[model samples]
Target: MAPEPYTIPITVRGYETDSQGHLNQAVYLQYAEHARWTYLQHGGIRQSDLLDKGIGPVALEVTVRYLRELRAGDETEVDCRFVWGEGKTFRIEQQIRRTDGTVAAEVTGVGGLLDLQARKLVADPREYFRALADDPAVFGL
Candidate 1:
């Protein structure tokens, strides 16, 4: 079975808007990152834990699709879930939806664990991520 999506509520702030009074494209990435971090933390993986292990998460690629515009003061929810992959590489899908039920943005990203010292991808991923994926076979566990 696939892992269930995790969602967090968000509200657009004044500073996050662009000249047109809509959410800036860059902020969408930040929102996705925030949701990912929150999800990881909830799964028992913290930034310090990764640093202590000399590993850091790195995104290989990301594709974001803008569907609806989000204006300042709009209430939204960001949802994320893991799409398992081989080795240490995995994918994640995230969506930001307005309170009215319209999708504001959708992001699909490929990422992996990096060996900070070696400056290379880590073949053996940490257990926290494996648990997050909820599919041991995908990570060869």
Candidate 2:
């Protein structure tokens, strides 16, 4: 079987919903961001550590497609996976699914490494991030 995408459970809160009683579209990105952080942590890299090295990951673009509605108090899972791109750029695919396994939303994000010191994108990142970019199994090779 192929490797499973990284998943994290999230509970919808009242503050995350809009007047329509459904989760706000903007909140969906927050969920995906959390899952991305957790995924990176699982891979032994932390945002703080990256910042300390004067390098950070930055999202170039993010597209979110809302499917089913998610109301407050609903339990959901966010699944995330990394897709390799040219050089240090890569894509992350995330989905928010209801407890019943129905997809609530899908988020596709493009990102790349940044050199904090130089204040620009880096074509060649350090070994830690480079490893993730080069690993085919990370995206389920």
Candidate 3:
């Protein structure tokens, strides 16, 4: 079958919920983070490689729109898509869905590559993204 439009498997923890009885808004950000990392791995950049290479990514901006409340013990899958941008800045749109396949939230992020040592934007890792954009599967191929 062709790749699904989005597929990221993740579990919700009890601590993820707040006194409000639903997931805290911050937790959704955490999920977006987890989804982003998973997406990178699926796209070909491993965290080990980033750490070893002294190259990492940083989020310039993040916007999340919560559509429904997610509770503890819930399992969800995220659907993500790449949005192109200049230089090290790129965008990814992610939709979080409950086990029943209903949307729980939407996350949009503007992120960029960073040279961890200099604490500044770098162009090297962007090449990784550029290559990934061409054919994500090929990274593992």
Candidate 4:
């Protein structure tokens, strides 16, 4: 279930910085999440489609490992890869890298397919993702 690697080049905006002159930890998650969304959109999962489907994907767990400090003006990119999961979950592993190819941080988020109304995990993950994976209108499927 590996989607193509997505590179998100970012300019460290002032709002994303802290008084410490570096990006705040929360901003890292935000950046990674954006990268994930960008990958999904590129793959063909549009927000309108999701809304029409009456389903939602929510993160059930995450692991964030910071390897180095990034300061303002550092050109960086986040590479994202989607992986298989157990049950109704999908796992995405991502690495935020510097222009020199140094790993700045690693993040993994486990997202569960949910029934929008009941707010419960879907019973069949394969069928659900397959629908998305199959509909070229919905995915690179």
Cα lDDT of candidate 4 equals 0.77
| Residue 43 displacement (Å), model 2 | 1.5
Model 2 per-residue lDDT tens digits across residues 1-141: 446899999999999999899999899999999999988777667788787778888999999999999999999999998776557677788899998999999999888888888888887544547455344355444
1 or 4, greater by lDDT: 1
**How many residue pairs clash (N, CA or C atoms closer than 3 angstroms) in each of the candidate models, in the order given?**
0, 0, 0, 1
Candidate 4 segments whose C-alpha is farther than 4 A from its true place: 1-3, 133-141
Please give, for residues 1-141, the per-residue lDDT of candidate 1 as tens digits.
Answer: 665688899999999999999999999999999999988776667788788878889999999999999999999999887776657778889999997899999999999889899999888564656555444443333
lDDT of each: 0.84, 0.83, 0.75, 0.77
lDDT string, candidate 3, 1-141, tens digits: 234444678788888789977988998888878877777776666787677767777888889998998888889997776665556677778899998989999999887778889998776444666454435543222
Candidate 2 residue 36 Cα shift, in angstroms, is 0.6
lDDT (10s digit) by residue, model 4, range 1-141: 433577879877777788998888898999898988887676667666666788877888989999988888889999787676556777778999899999989999888777898888887655665666534333323
What candidate 2 gets wrong by more than 4 Å, as runs, is: 130-141
lDDT at residue 62 of model 1 (Cα atoms): 99
Instruction: Show the lowest summed lDDT stretch of 10 residues, model 4.
Output: 132-141
TM-score of each: 0.88, 0.87, 0.79, 0.87
lDDT of 4 at 25: 89
Relative to the true structure, candidate 4 reaches a TM of 0.87
Q: Which consecutive 10 residues in model 2 have the weakest lDDT in total?
A: 132-141
Error of 2 at 3 (Å): 3.6
Root-mean-square deviation of every model = 3.2, 2.9, 3.6, 2.6
Inter-residue clash pairs, candidate 1: none
